[model samples]
Target: MRPARALIDLDALRHNYRLARRLGGGKALAVIKADAYGHGAVRCAQALEGEADGFAVAFLEEALALREAGIAAPILLLEGVLAADELPLVAEHDLWMVVHAPWQVEALARATLPRPLDVWLKLDSGMHRVGIDAEAYATTWQRLRALPQVGGLVKMTHFSRADEPDHERTREQIDTFAAVTAGLPGETSLCNSPALLAWPQARGDWARAGLMLYGASPFAHGHAAGAQLQPVMTLESQVIAVRDLPAGEPVGYGGTFVAPRPTRVGVVAMGYADGYPQFAATGTPVAIDGRPGRLIGRVSMDMLTVDLTDHPDAGVGSRVELWGRQVAATEVVARSQTSAYRLLCGVKRVPLVSVGG
Candidate 1:
């Protein structure tokens, strides 16, 4: 065995979900898209199946996988039907979907289905990515409302900068959403993980919990509410080899890090192949035998070196934590010049072990 594995704390997952529901001030759809941000969708869904209000995925296939796995909770297709041809499958699986574009609406109007499907009308409040324009929102809503396929409708929007708690754009988007859907008849779902944590005023009838549910703070800096999140994935490995290198010796590829002094470099059995960031700069945090350490040099595909000069007792076979409770994934993400979502979802080639469910 490689001695590299990701410890998944399902209890922490449940805690984060409850926290999202509490802070968002409504029922929440646990966003499990991208395989629960790469935590393994079926397993994550199973962990939350009992308590989750519902689950949301990026597309219909993801919803179908959940359905095949026997997840009976309401599943929403965030991206909705691709070509209206997916509508039959959507209805057959009792799936909900977000009708974001005009084409989606037209498709809904054209499709005859087994049963009426719950539809979420996404408004392009500020983010220009998708959704109906403000001017056309009401008309689009009317079109969808008149459709025999739509059983229920929910007003939805995405925040581009909710992670920045003090940003004015979030307020602007909130106002825009409120104004556009003022008289519309349906439940509202606006807040994502960051909005649910930072903008109370942006909270709607349902919150989409994503990154926060993985116990990683969405904000770049410390936040009062973000502090409550408990990291669910602990990426751990072991020191495979130890080197006592003299000063000025370069380590790893590109000679990126040179020993400032006599250094004890511990080779960890985890790397980019296992989803560790290849470009993670020197000084990225690592934990060795429960002691603080720093990653050194460029990361290799199968191994990464860590500074163990401070830990005289640390050597080969010492436990190493790439990121988890001890070394927060947020810190690793910040140092790696990546996002928590990417880092977590990028994890591969490593076995996942569930615990504390």
Candidate 2:
């Protein structure tokens, strides 16, 4: 097989985690969900174990996967208990759960366990997601507090748009969240990756960050490249074939790129199947032998051709970075009409091997 792969800079992972702590100025829970958002949960959790206070995932299976990998640190399930029968495994595994709905509360309130389960209550300050309303927030907190089946309860909520620092909606969310649990009990978690990095006010007793630790900017407007944040995952492939096409020769599917002039086209061993965005525009950037290059056709399921006529040194077996230190994944995501979060997590078949663990 080719060396096409995603090299993860784990040292940068620690730095980004610490960045969250530094910016938020509070306890931080590294949100390592979606397999650490495609960084591999076991691998990411190990890198983040000692540095972060804990890790939060979408549900129980992800937490259990980490446990299977011998990760003993705290892991919180952001989605909470998926079933009442699994509470034993949760308690046995020492995994914390988030209670978002009334049934989850009632399930815990009625279950008889060896002791109370560690849980966090989800508050719907805004976003209008799965969280309970303010009225329910107060009542459920009190009710869950009284239940011996539930252990320490933490307050948690998701941010709608912390990426856009100038957006007033985030301000409204912070204010509403503060108002909801102003005088209530236990620590609170409001900040995600963007909030942890930008909104100092959103930092609560605890914060759950998902993206920044991966070194990709969640900000849709611009990035703080001056802050010294480094990219974590570098996805690179190589040219498997190269051909000099005559003028007007179309390239790839549907002839998306009909060369205006004779051109040198190279097919790189990456496509949507390899996690490269299928919708990557014709002019989307790629890097060949450390030189800037551009994809010239539709991103196929297995391979995509890039226009490499400008690089005299470029040839078959040459290195090509889809996105990384050389080609920013954020920039590609922008050109692909998608977000880095989706692009990073959507990668398949490409192994994420650690570069600087």
Candidate 2 lDDT: 0.85
Runs of candidate 1 exceeding 4 Å displacement: none
TM-score of each: 0.98, 0.97
Lowest summed lDDT window (length 10), candidate 2: 220-229
Q: How accurate locally, in lDDT, is each candidate? A: 0.94, 0.85
lDDT of 1 by residue, 207-242 (tens): 999999999999999999999999999999999999
How high a TM-score does candidate 1 get?
0.98
**Which ten residues in a row are the worst by lDDT in model 1?**
105-114
